[model samples]
Target: MYALYYTPGAASLVVHWLLLELDQPHELRAVDIAAREHKDASYLALNPNGVVPTLLVDGQPRYEAAALAMLLADRHGDGAFAPAPADPQRAEYLQWMFNLTATLQAPLRLWWYPGDLQCDDEAVRRGARARFEAACERLDAHLGAHGPYLLGERLSAADFYLTMLMRWSRNLPRPAHDRPHLGALARRMKARPSFAELYRREGLEEWA
Candidate 1:
């Protein structure tokens, strides 16, 4: 069985969502980041990075959320979360997913580590927040132009990844609500059946 090492309310949310979408039989194993269980020796051996959301596919460990999503999508069916490889939008689909990880997710990490790593200097924190807002604004505008999903109409892995990011970003004191379209996109995604299923399995009551 597919064994997913996850931490509830973490990046694992998307992985959980996608696994439910695939309707595959799998096991959800929680790794407590608070107690430092993710950093344990065995977990380190399985995933040297010691990060949560490691997918154990038939015993071999697979880390990295985006790569895991792509692998799962491709394995389940080429046409699942992403379009067929030949589709014109495929390029943008891949681009958005990676861009979310590199550009969008970085700022959220700053929010998590604000006091420790980023908020040391007022000027530095302000600059980081400014850059983060710009990125979110760009995403908001692009999402508004698309009018539903990142790919215009159909849902893709890009939307799943991005929507989860937006949701977490919204929880910050600054909130992504200022970006109405982005907020709407996140709401639409949260309302999805697959998202609800994963949330339930993970015991994420706050997500509802």
Candidate 2:
């Protein structure tokens, strides 16, 4: 069984959702970020970064939500939710996974937490928002051309990852779900039973 340390509706949602999607045996250990539990000594031991979603796999701790998602999908050996090493779609899969984490997720994080960029200047925040929207535009175009899934016809961990990020964008100036293609994608993904289960389990509402 896997142990996942998480705070509801955070980046942790993606990894937790992936585990359930795979029907993997796992337990969620809540680390209440609001109460500063994550910064405490005990939780710090599990995740020095003091963030949510610290995953313990085979009794070893790992952090970073996207990396954990990739690891779990790869480790499962089914290659249905994730491509195996030799799969032909592997290249595109890797490309978008890295792109989503690096390009799209980075700007969203910066935009959402402007303090992390060291100044609450509106200009800086606006720039961050602009960057994120541009990234979304690119993603929208890609989906319009080749999606129903990030990898053309088949869904993957990348889509789940995208779902979490898109959920975050609900409060943005031009929210991700407002884009026609992205909106359609979000609607399709939200229809999955796992999505409803995740909402109920995590107590997430509003963005739905």
Candidate 3:
């Protein structure tokens, strides 16, 4: 059985969503960050980074949300959540997944936990917000051009990853919903049973 360690609304959400989407039987171990449980020895052995979303694949530890998503797609999705190697859309699909992590998700990390940047200045906050919105603007344009989903008509695991990010962006000056196309995509995705189940299980009420 698959086992996952996570906190609500953390990067783990997308992985949890994927596990449900694939109907994969799994176990959830909530690492209470509030109590510093993640930093404790047992959790660290499974995930050295002491972060959420650590997956035990056949009892072997796997971390990184994006990597776990790709792993799931590769193992079980069979060109559904991801385009296969020979598929025409594979290159673009790969691009969006990497870009989603680097360009979009990375900045939101700093935005949410600015203390990681080692400065509490308002200027730093402005810079992080600008980076976040800029990434969203690029995604919004892409969604407008070819989207409601990341891979055009195909809804890949990338779409779920993006949705998870956008949900966290709800408190920003310009949330994902502020962008017309992105907003529409989010609205459509929110209707999915996978997302609904994620929120219910995670107890995340915001941006649901």
- RMSD, candidate 2, Å: 1.1
| lDDT score of residue 208 within candidate 3 | 76
Q: What tens digits encode model 3's per-residue C-alpha lDDT throughout 24-65?
A: 999998988999998999988888998988999987999999
Give a tens-digit lDDT track for model 1, residues 136-187.
8888898788767888987888888887777676666566645788878878
Lowest lDDT 10-residue stretch of candidate 2? 112-121
What C-alpha lDDT values do all the predictions have?
0.80, 0.88, 0.88
- Model 2, TM vs. native: 0.96
Clash tally, candidates in order: 0, 0, 0
- The runs of at least 3 residues in candidate 2 whose Cα sits more than 4 Å from the true structure, single-residue gaps closed, are none
In order, what is each prediction's RMSD in angstroms?
2.0, 1.1, 1.1
Question: How close to the true structure is residue 79 of candidate 2, measured as C-alpha lDDT?
Answer: 79
